[model samples]
Target: MYLRRKPIFFLFLLLHPVFINAQFFADRLKSFMSTAAVSAVQYPKEVKEFYELNSYRFSWLEKQNAEQLALLSDYIRSSPSLGLSAGDYHPEIFPIAAIHENDSLLTEISFTDAAIHFLHDLMMGNKAEPLSYDGLKYVPACYNAAALLNVYLSPGRFANLLTDLEPKEAGYLAVKTKLNAWLKITSAEKYEDVAVAVSKTLRGNKNGLTRLYQLGFVASDTASLSEPALKAALKEAQKMFSLLSDGELRSTTVQALNVPLATRIAELKNTLNTLRWLHCVKQERHVALVNIPSATLLLYEHGKLVIESRIIVGKKSTPTPTLSSTITEVILYPYWNVPYKIATRELLPAIKRNTGYINANNYQVLNSSGKVVDPYKVNWRSLSAGNFPYTIRQSTGCDNALGLVKLNFYNPFSVYLHDTPGKSLFGLDRRYFSHGCMRLEKAMELGRYVLTGNAVAIDTLTEKGCLKNQSPITVPATEKIPVFVLYHTAWIDGTGMLHFYEDVYNRFSPGRKP
Candidate 1:
């Protein structure tokens, strides 16, 4: 009976190599993981789940393949070119030679650790240093380790997966190429201080023209170029910085050139991170993006840019909030419902000085119950800043604070995009004038584009003289455009030109070296 039982057990063991192999390798992996160079804390939760799902099978190690180890080594060493710190992944801790010491446990553990760290940094940008300011509330996308591993394990897809990990936007790729150029040339050339408007051309000064060539702003040999050629190069540079393009060495132009190369590189890094964050959204339909720092609005349809316009964002004290929402409707000659803070802090003093101010501006005072209250009935003298109990609303007209068109979106800040009567402000280089809303430069064009599919409503409103009428014209958007209001001080244009805007809110302080 004992001999018969032994043979049965041996047969059962021989038929279960799949389970036996998995159990044997899993035990070794668990033992190596306990004493691995990388700690458990360093492994993200998703990575742990990935290993559990695979039953601790080694992903990067195929019986200690040298080709796989070399690929990882090259990738880690090339991280700096992508504005990443290879040291954070610590690839040097486990040299290829050390990994190939013929100890399978050590080799497998090291290979897994290096591959996971490299992937983490590549997918999510090198975890940004703690920011000192809250001016930007954008959060970067994190990696799902299990999904990433699945992609890696799939045949003939690893290369594509690697390409997809980086930002696929043209702007980001252009900026990254520029970053590499900046790294190679290492320019310290700076312009001298000048007045607001300087009419001199860099061709007059041979040294200045040489510096321009070094900075890659000119197309040809700048040093030997004629005065007209030099002026054209300077004009191009001015345009790149969003200046007036007067082809002169103005103070603002000089200041832009004097910005250190290292500072520009840091801005490029921040822009790359921002691109990664923005690219995570898969929307390809009609969308509107408002770049706060640049004070510009861009509209895209089917992933193609259709409209670009200047905009006036909020001032430093009441800066616009970064958020994402959908524009559901466009209101023509809409009434401006004054916020409580604006009513008590900005307009109350004017009303006190002149009782007719409200009448002159077509404003009406209303109680909480929606009953119109006579302005004269309210004791202007007794209404302290805190004790004001009335809401001031501007009637619909050309003189309305919101101009002719207002874009309605769902946001807690109660901020919207609208036209402004202050048209001259749009021509200024620095346009931060609004309380919190965005003032569009070409508001009518934006309105026409958003109301494209609803042509009858727009035509009817235009025929009815909506602009001059006091009655509001509501146009329901047939196609809702997703609006993303974000702040990016640095970006690249479709022409592959690097554009840098002043950090008006001062969100990024580049103190930590990469």
Candidate 2:
């Protein structure tokens, strides 16, 4: 009994070192607050205290030579990165396993269990929902990408979004490409029986694998599935799914089963005949493309539109042209140019009357060949408002129409998204206030997103030298990422009550008649 007591004494001493060391770090943090006024919108103090205690526990575990405890400590120390608490594994914020049914064969499923456990923990509310850093700040971002998919598909299931593509139209269209690849692996040309068995297991299982399979197939851009084609597709999916761990799959298996089977799939006949079934209904963008009442921008992802605030858009006289585009280039310090229309109508008339008018506004005179002519060398009065064929380029620096940054995308309209120095508009409920470019409130966050992501370490296009005119770099996405800019006059807020915003663009109710 005396000998046993000695061992306990030894353990106490081991933990003493960790306790003493951690106290110093905690004091330093408290001292920091003394010197500075605390920042507004800070996280709860309990959060900070928990992390500090995690450090102390980590030290104590390390001294005891407990590797598992030490690892747990490490996770606690880096809780922000792990998105977990000390010795705690939340079981609900995410999914346990995700079962995707094979597309080609109507009865097969693809299982990915590795990542499901972590996701399942998050979804169960066992852990803190981690925040995502959006450039300059952080906000509550979803921990589970799969859960995001669930939220995404909630309003309208997979088949409903693709009303444009008929079941027979799956040959080479971009929308059908994803399905074609998936079908190649799932149909089991390589092992037909295995494919059928897999599908049967998913459908028969209570876990919703069948629905996932259905969703995956519907989201794809394929028209038909053959045994060989589907087998090939599943092979690819298997490779992608292998990245997760077994424990994860076990956790989210339940969430994977929760999906709404979606309206009457088996009833769609043409899809069955082609060894493929696709929903033939589509919801138009008209409803999503309208405006809100307040002065803010309505944001959208995929086809589902949600209005956050009301915003101003370019006047229709010089209306913003709608087109397919992505942010390609982001200029840190931007230059403004007098658009051709403005030059021809506004500046040209002034130049014809007052010679010094061009100099006063800092507009540079340029010839037809795009060469800058000295302001003094050219006869400003010689150019008539109707003959304003020459270009008027604005110099860089302050007072430029565009703020400090501008995002460029390829479009026939030569329009670029940007930030404006006129912050007054942010307060106005009616914010439709641009010539013809997107003005973003969260432009910095957009920049951060564009800069971070996966890229192939292929050939270095350019090894050295400063790269100006930074063109848009296309990053092939492994998962579906949707972006939408929309306008809605009415939407449900947190309390689910309908809210309205000012339709500054007048796109919602044309002429504001309603």
| Best candidate (score: lDDT) | 1
How well is each residue in 199-292 modelled by candidate 2, as lDDT tens digits? 4223233222333354353243333444454444444333222212222223222222221221111111111221111011012221112122
Q: Give the Cα error of residue 238 in candidate 1, in Å.
A: 1.4
lDDT (Cα atoms) of all candidates against the true structure? 0.68, 0.37
Cα lDDT tens digits for candidate 1, 1-514:
0011223223432342222244676787666555643253355455556677777876654433333444455666666667776676645443433233235555455555556766766655555423323223434444665657555655555445456666566776777887777766564355332222244656567555654664576644334787888878788777767788988887777766666667777777777655555543323567787888889888777656677899999888999888778888999879899999999998999999998999998899998788889998888999977798788999877678898789998888899999877788998878888898999987877888778877666566556653543777788887777788877777655444668776677675442111
The per-residue C-alpha lDDT of model 2 at residue 313 equals 59
Alpha carbon lDDT at 195, candidate 2: 13
Q: In candidate 1, how many Å is residue 62 off?
A: 4.4
C-alpha-based local distance difference test score of model 2: 0.37
TM-score of 2: 0.36
